[model samples]
Structure formats: structure tokens, C-alpha cells
Target: MKKHLILLLLWAVVGVSARAQKPATVTIPKNKYGLQVVSSTALYQQLVEQNPDQELVELATYIPGLVLDIKYATPDNLVKEPVYTMATAYARKPVADALKKIQEELKPLGLGLKIYDGYRPYHVTELFFKKVKKKAYVANPKNGSRHNRGCAMDLTLITLKDGKELEMPTPYDATVKQSHPDYPHVSEQVKKNRALLINTMQRHGFTVFHNEWWHYDFNEWPKYPLMDIRFEDLKAMKN
Candidate 1:
């Protein structure tokens, strides 16, 4: 009887822990953003295309104004990006929801999200690995990437009034140390703006990777799946 009672108590404690974890839990839906905090499962379907293996390519449901990414476009692979500036969100819902909150908080200041990339195909990740080495900003295709997992994003800030990419210390995939947000030569205003973005993201539910100014992940990233589904496969699924 004592053993059974102990097991019951342990079960009760486990149940309570799970409830506490829900607030921080993240879900992976078709193309929605935010690492966790997903409360639904109505996934956006990927449009299928004819492939060698009779597979399909899938894409996330894009919020209006955002363009599907073309840099990595190929029947072999497809990358999608959210529209910049207008707040026609490009990230998955959890990410979108988080951005929406930031928008509400930053709109009065004339600031907004200028997304460049999201939902990277594993093939593109491999392409980066093939071109860029594993030092600093570079990643290894064999090891896997956060973007491939759909939990990471490459982004920057912009003004709704003028659609220009903000002046950051370095360009995307820049391998130089000068690109670090803390580079001494970078203006204090830029640093301040970077900090505001980082802090705001952290406060809302993200953890910033110190080396990269624009990279952040939901605290629950480990729970998500690492996907290598090619754009072609996604397209084939759509059919």
C-alpha cells in the first residue's frame, strides 16, 4: 500500500510539472513561426510538384505582402521568406504572434520587422555548408542547422515608411569579426537598436545567440524535429 501511495504522489507531481511546462511549450505547424507556444494543428498544405521520387514540396501559408523566398528557389529546393516592413508577417504563427506583440510595442516608434529569410530547406543549409566552412558564422551540412529545423530565422529591422534594410555592421553570412553587434566601430545607435531588438525578443520568449546579432531561438527549440525534407518532396506532397 505504501508503494502504491508513493507512485500516486509521483504521478501527481509529474502532472503538475507538465502543466507548468505548457506556457513554455512550442509547436511546429506547417509554416508558422515561433519555436513553441503552438496550441493548434491546422497545418498549411505544401503545394506538390512532380519529382523524381513522386514526392512533393511544401511551403508555409504566407501572410499577405511577404514574398516566398527565391534565393534558394529550385524545383530541387524552395526557400520561403516573409514580406518586410508592412507587417504582412512571414514567420510561423508562434513566431508571428510574438512579432505581432513586438509590432504593437514598436509601431509608435516607426520600427517594424524586415525579414529576409525563414523556413530554409535542408538542401540550402547543405549549400551553405558546401560554400561556407564551419568556422564562426559557417555551418556544416552534416551537423544540421537551426534554420533547417524551422525554429531559427535570419532577420533585421526596417521602417514602414521607407523599405530599406537597416544599416547593420555586416552583411548576411559575413564571416568577418566586424559584423559582431559589439564591434567598436559600429555606431552606438545601431548597438542600442540591436539591443532593443534582442531584449524585446528575449522578454517575449526567445534566447539570443550572442555571436549573431539577428539570431534567436525559442527556449523550447530542443523539442522540435530536425527536418531535411527537400523542396521537391514538399511540392510532391502538395499534389
Candidate 2:
């Protein structure tokens, strides 16, 4: 009878373990009209569990002979440089598709998008506000932000032929008058590249924020939800 009692105890323990292992879901109180927030702890697992027939963004436009890596390119595990990567589907599938469409349009001109920022978390948004003042180029963390919703992105133009960056007048995060729209003394190339980005993204249904040259929000961003989920969660969701 001792063996029977032990088996009963073992079964009880397994029952409790199974109950405890249930995944938790984070319920978002609200989401933007065009965008949906991904707040659930189980979101990553849920996305991967499905055999969704998702399309990889069509990459029809390749720089004829360009090895077009961005400033974020990392040399190796040694951490020699920053890592360059294309935006993945989990965060903003539409944005990824937009990039592909932009690439297709610009292939003839030998230009490509060199993305600097996309799908930023609230934590990163807070950090950004700390570094840059709000008057000129600002991203407030308290209220809604594009990066928070994964509906906005910042990018610049690069030569598709040699993969070298073009002249943007100022580098990323400059936040000065030169980066302003009315700062007329800049080169025509700067304006042209900026316009190219604006027109292309707008064609693909993105709304441009006038103050900043590189900033864009999807027209459908209101349908998406805010995502506090980290980079790891995004990767997990992609699988």
C-alpha cells in the first residue's frame, strides 16, 4: 500500500506542476487606432506556435554590385562594430514591406534606405528624450510615440552601387537647425535625398512628420498596438 500512496502523491505533484506552467498574457488597456500593441508575455510563444504562411518582404531591388551594409554592421562576436540588420516582421511587417517597395522604386537611381531606428521600446524612448531636447527634434516618452508603437522609423539614403552613405548635411541625432526644414544653406543632394525618402514612404502609406526629415509614421499605425516587448521577444515572435 506504500507504493500506491507514493504514486498518488506523484500524480498530485504533476497536476500542480502543469497548472503552474500555464503562460501569462499581458492585456493592454488600449491601443492606437491604426496599430496594435503587442504586450502579452505569451505573444512570442503564440506567434511561433502557429504555421502562418507569412511572406518574406520581397527583395527585388539589389544594388547592382553593392555590398550595402549600414553603419550598424558588426565585424564579428568580438564586437568590432555595430550590427546592421533589416527590420523583421514581428515588430512591423508593413514597414518591412514598405522598405522592400522603396528599394524596388529606388533601384534605378542606385539609392537604398539605411535605417537608423525602428521599433523602439518605451525605455529607449525615455533615454532618447533625456539626450535630446524637445524644442527641436524630440520624442516624448509619456505620450504616444511611433517607435513605441513600432509604426514609425528613421532612415537615410545610401548609394546602392558601393554601399557608401550619401550626404545628409548632418549625421543621425544631430538635432540642430541644419537638420531643420527651413535651413536653406544645405546642399541640393541633401534635400533631394530627404524628398526621395518622404515621397517613397508616402506612396506606401506613411505620414511624414515635417520637423524631422527622417521620421515617418504609417497611415495604418492607428490600427497597431504599443509594444513594450523587447528585442528578444520580437525575435521569438518571428519564428
Candidate 3:
């Protein structure tokens, strides 16, 4: 009986040590609003393995000559503080492909898309809801913004030669009425510039947001899941 007990104790110790040697899997729980955000990089990788379209491609690297002005990464945004550690832009595979095509189309016109923001983390959206006063401009945390899904892009038109921004109705992230896509109080030059942006994005797979002239949502935004992955983690991901 003593020998049997000793062997059983050794077996238990071996089992415990084996379990301890294995890495623990991280699991993300639903947020207070009950939204199942993809916060785990492992889970995101698994999804990408299942569907190549689920991969979030870095926009700057994927799109040639793509100009990025990530406002959320600086203190210049509506939040008045830096929300992201890196000034980077990323989007789903399909969204990147569409943007690439759009860049190609705009080359002939001496205009290019300048991205202000893209692929916003879910936590940043929550922060924006708290800091932003205009409910119309900021997305509610309850329903997660399309930006959190890597499907929405905040951008404007820029000259390819001088890299200067085109005249638009309002500045990026403006909450004023003039920011509306159909706001008619602006000058003809602003109107023409806004129309050019809206029309070009519409010709592709993007639809302009009704309230924001610089914001565009991919037609397939519904397919991607809301993601809370940080930009640094995405950059660290192996190609």
C-alpha cells in the first residue's frame, strides 16, 4: 500500500508539472455591452487562417504611395490626446485591395487618398464616445463603429505632386454641420473637391458617410468582426 501511494503521488506531480509547462490560452470575455470583440491575437490569427479575407493588411505597406495622417495617434484629434501608440493604418484584405484600386484610379487625376484613420480599436471607440460631445458624430459603444471592424476609412483627397490636401467643407473629425456631405453653404471649389472625393469613392467599393465628407465605409463592412487588437500587435504579426 505504501509503494502504491508513492507511485500515485509521483503520477500526480508529473501531471501537474506537465500542465504547468504548457502555455495558458488567453480568452477575451464580452464587454459590458455584450459585444464579442476580437481582442485575442491568437483568435484573430485563427480566423485569418480560416479565411484569408479576415487578415488585416497594413495599409501603408499594402497600398503604394498611400499617404497616412493618423490623427488618433497624435494629440490633434477630437480626443485631444494620443489614443494609439503608433501612427499606422490597417484594413481587411478586401478593403486594402479596394483602396489600392482607388489609388490607381486617382493617379491619372493627380490626386491621391490621404488616410486620417483606419482600423480603430474597439477600446478607442469607447474612449471617443466618452470624450466627444456630439452623439451624432461619435459612434455609440453599444453598436461598435465600422472603424472597429477594419472596414471604415477616414480620408480625404490630396494632390499627388505637392502632397497638399484639397479644399473640403470641414476639417477632419469636425462635428459641425458643415461637415455633412450635402452641406451646401461651402464655396464652389470646396463643393467640387468634396464631390470629386465622394464620387471617386462611390465608383469604387466605398460609400461616403452621410454626416462626414471625409469618412467612407466599405460596402462589405458587415462581414468583418469588431476588433480590439492594438496597432503594435498587428505590426508585430509575421507576414
Name the runs in model 1 displaced over 4 angstroms: 1-92, 230-239
Q: What is the TM-score of each predicted model, taking all chains together?
A: 0.60, 0.65, 0.87
State the weakest 10-residue window (summed lDDT) of model 3. Answer: 21-30
Error of 2 at 92 (Å): 1.3
Candidate 2 local lDDT, 63-107, one digit each (tens): 222222233234331123333343332235666667667777878
lDDT of 3 by residue, 92-180 (tens): 99999999999999999998989999899999989999999888998999999999999999999899999999999889998999999
lDDT of 2: 0.59
lDDT score of residue 31 within candidate 2 = 48
Q: Model 2: how far is 154 from its true place, Å?
A: 0.8
lDDT of each: 0.52, 0.59, 0.91
Top model by lDDT, which number?
3
Model 2, total clashes: 19
List candidate 3 segments past 4 Å from native. Answer: 1-29
Please write out the lDDT profile of model 1 over residues 170-231, one tens digit for every residue. 76545677666566777887777777877878887877665777667756555444554544
